[model samples]
Target: MLPVDTTQLLKGVLDLAVLAVLRDEDGYGYDILRRLRTSGLTEVGDASVYGTLRRLFNAGLLSTYVVPSVEGPHRKYYALNAAGRGELQRSGKIWQDFASTMDDLLRERETA
Candidate 1:
């Protein structure tokens, strides 16, 4: 078997990544897009991020606020709420466990 494309694999965890980003600070759509790009997730699209934001907001994991910036239009910023923080903590632990399992499997295959 060939090595997995981690870029493709990352799609499964994009929600978690977004949650983690929001954990840093309240930010607008474009700011979140830029931050995710800067973090080496070059495949992420702005629309995808926006859609995720909407979904998360609908699910009550995120709360949005309008912020006025002189340079541009009023921005709708997203902040993680208590529910979101708790969800992130749970998901983070689960991801760690899954990653550890994958690492072990890959290492075993490499040795074999």
Candidate 2:
């Protein structure tokens, strides 16, 4: 059996993962990337996360604001808007259903 390419898998679900991370708190690009890595998605890359954030913002699913930082440059934090929250809910349900189906199939194979 071939090993799964998790980076490819992460590409498919990066939007969902980013939205999930922003569900609780708004964060800047690097902070969001860090949260994802800390949550065990260490394979997620900085560029991927930044691109995802930009896409989400452009799609009207996210809002951004700049916060001044004394230590460095201003940070643009991304937050989930109403549409983003709705999308998170809708996509989250779809993901749950798909995951359940996959789990069931794998379990059946194990039993067989």
lDDT of each: 0.91, 0.97
Model 1 residue 99 distance off true place after TM-score fit, in angstroms: 0.6
Q: Which tens-of-lDDT digit does each residue in 1-110 have in candidate 1? A: 99978767777888899999999799998899899889998889788899888988999999999988799789999999999999899999999999999999999999
lDDT of 2 by residue, 1-112 (tens): 9999999999999999999999999999999999999999999999889999999999999999999999999999999999999999999999999999999999999999
After superposing candidate 2 on the true structure, give the runs of residues whose Cα lies further than 4 Å from its correct spot. Answer: none
Weakest ten-residue segment in model 1 by summed lDDT: 4-13
What are the clash counts of all predictions, listed in order? 0, 0
Residue-level lDDT for 78 in candidate 1 = 98
Per TM-score, the best of the predicted structures is 2
TM-score of each: 0.91, 0.98
* Pairs that collide, model 2: none
